[model samples]
Target: MNEQQFSKSMTYAPGLPEGATFYSAHKKRVTSHAVANAVEAALKERGVTIEDIAEIVLDLQKPFMSGLTIETCAENVRGVLAKRELQHAILVGIELDRLAEKKMLSEPLQSLVDQDEGLFGVDETIALGAVSSFGSIAATTFGYLDKVKPKIIGRLDLEKEGKVNTFLDDLIASIAADASSRLAHRVRDEEEKRLSQNNGK
Candidate 1:
């Protein structure tokens, strides 16, 4: 139930079209699974079980955005990650964008920019995983997490191309916090479903 397996060939593509179930479901599965694993691992580290951490993470990681979208989720994910890691993600995304803008681009990373290739979004997925992991924490600094949780797809920076480190971090912190909170909801949902089945049996 916690694991998400998808087609290996579907990580990256040109763009996320408006109505694409595979893309949407795949991204959501990847995101939820990452958050779930993070909660489980964090609780384990603290000598607890998945059920114990569920409520905490859910209270922590609710999405800030009213309606969650990939772009918005990505923004919150980036900020919610952490200081050093957010910086890294911003830098990586910036560099990728910059590389795409360059006069002469290399073949290896070109697909990453052109969006013509399918594997370009791998880095984004990884960065989201990191944020989900740390966002599972329920520290007080989570105010920042609360503040930025609602704008999952909003702009991180006003006029800059890639200065999203500080900007996006704020938003992502909220997303992470909200996502953490959602963990409790998800776990509870799973438990209810299981109990209902057992009762039927």
Candidate 2:
């Protein structure tokens, strides 16, 4: 049925509250899978892929992890992407960038975002807030990438025309940093498990 028909068909549960109504079609239950898909789609629209972030994670983690595979790095990146906190940050930051690209923002804000001015630190702030959940390692790694602008981050930062990636570049860095931190902790856990098994023997 059409949306209006569907909305009309919905009935409120037994309740005494006056003017209370059932959820509408626009308020349909959102699934975790749908949110995850949107986050992935947002990244893809901005020319980023899981592998792109995974490569940075591998660069950050491989030195300390023997025989580390790109597949493992990609897996950890996916794991980080699944967090609601990170997903929220990705959506918000990308939306801002998109708005800026369309010059929808006002005055100094629009100019700052479009130019990605040196004084414009809000982008990094949002990215850092999201990565902070992963602890100090992730936070510091984000700072490094923000400064160095390695690989995809560098490319995004350098794009001047027809795009505004002020927030996206830092968001990508944060994602990679957080994933690397997660992989590090996972490796440490596995090592400890092995050591504990050896001690038990």
Candidate 3:
């Protein structure tokens, strides 16, 4: 069959889109929900409860917007997770953490993961990529969260018997920071909308 005919004959699935050829048609793309699920599972494995995540969400939102509900905080998290680049970063960071925990990396790399080396900044660097989604505030928020290590983050940072959360800790902090930035932007948008309506009236 001709290339054009082959392309025209391709059928795409719900979440998959057809490409110029049939080989690319069945390729599966990662969705935001999948990224969120991976994050949630990692948190759960580390004993982070849903309530703990909710508390972080609330803490991040309360300072920027008054009377914001937990539901809204969750929605912000979902929105932040939906970004494709952010998802890639989270997955990659988490996978590195897992590989480190398993001692699957090279000698120096494995040692850094095992010892939680002070000079090893690679994990933090990976997490930093996610901060740009929400602007400078996200970076500031991440710094704060990293310093304070509140809620489950504190738990992750604390040395445990058999667990290494070096990367997970940073990943979680970035997520919270991103969520906080999202909430702040959304709150500002709503305030602007209200003011616009009042001026119209």
lDDT of 2 by residue, 10-33 (tens): 444433232333345544444566
Clashing pairs in 3: none
Q: Following a full C-alpha superposition, what root-mean-square deviation does model 1 have from the true structure? A: 16.1
Error of 3 at 156 (Å): 0.2
List the candidates' TM-scores in order.
Answer: 0.30, 0.86, 0.80
Report the CA-based lDDT of candidate 3 relative to the real structure: 0.75
Better of 2 and 3 by TM-score: 2
Question: Which tens-of-lDDT digit does each residue in 9-65 have in candidate 1?
Answer: 555643433233234555422233343344334324323332322333333344432
What does the lDDT come to for candidate 1? Answer: 0.41
What C-alpha lDDT, on a 0 to 100 scale, does residue 32 get in candidate 3?
Answer: 50
* lDDT for model 2: 0.87
- Candidate 3: deviation at residue 138, Å? 0.4
Residue lDDT tens for model 3, 45-71: 766555665578798778766787888
lDDT of each: 0.41, 0.87, 0.75
Clashes of each: 32, 0, 0
Highest-scoring model, lDDT: 2
Better of 1 and 2 by TM-score: 2
